[model samples]
Target: MSSVKETVDVAAPLRIAYNQWTQFEEFPLFMEGVDEVRQLDDRHNHWTTSIGGVRREFDTEIVDQLPDDRITWRSVAGDTRQRGSVRFERIDETHTRVELTMDVEPTGIAEKGADALGVIDRRVKGDLSRFKDYLESRGHESGGWRGRIRPADPGSPL
Candidate 1:
């Protein structure tokens, strides 16, 4: 499997960074390829993505999640296969570092060719930058999961 990872430091607390991400349904607000996300279960989600006019849908299972630390997932079934993790590190009481690592195999030869040529990296980086900007602009998480479809409770904040 091939991989691409990127990191960014945010001027926000770790909980702030983490809670925002835990709300996966909000991803389309920052992610470009994401058209929609529906929580299927606490650890499962369905996502729709579109890039360069090609649209695909996939279901992924959250392999692991540790609040204020990391969230990992891999495609359970889809047109394309992918696996990735987003890790959050508390740099200080008010600063956090976000790292993303993703390995993806395109479903078609055209998408594979584009990946070999660096298009995918650009898209990934752009998405991260957007997330950074959006998070910073918001200054706080908009809200959190209210749907009962989630597998586990968020529990009380520490």
Candidate 2:
């Protein structure tokens, strides 16, 4: 497994930053290679992505979610095996810091080679940078889901 960690500071409040992050369907706008994300429910999502010329689909289940703080998820079933978390920190009343950490398992030669060449790390960083641009440009979130998902509630709905 390979891991990538990246951080970015956005000119928005913690609530705005965190709220934007919850709209998974908008990820394709800022997240490179993410073709589409369907939020099946509050704690479930289906992702379709094309990375390094390879297209894949995956389903993820949110393991834990804390409003305006952090959200964690792991792939439940799909063509990829991975897990990740996003954390939100308040820098000030109008500034926020967002951090992302992900663990990915590369399958086949192409993916393994890309991971070995630090492509994944660069991608993560670029994605976060774009996210900063996206939120900063809008000056607010398009919409938000502030609901909490506890570890004990795996099938929670939005």
Best by lDDT: 2
- How many Å off is the CA of 132 in candidate 1? 1.0
lDDT of each: 0.83, 0.94
Candidate 1 Cα errors over 4 Å, as ranges: 145-158
Tens-digit lDDT track of model 2 for 10-34 = 9999999999999999999999999
Off by over 4 Å in 2: 153-158
What overall lDDT, based on C-alpha atoms, would model 1 receive against the true structure?
A: 0.83
20-92: candidate 1 lDDT, tens digit per residue: 8888898899898899999887888999998878999999988678777788888888786889999999999
Cα deviation at 113, candidate 1, in Å, is: 1.5
Clash list (residue pairs), candidate 2 = none
TM, every model:
0.88, 0.95
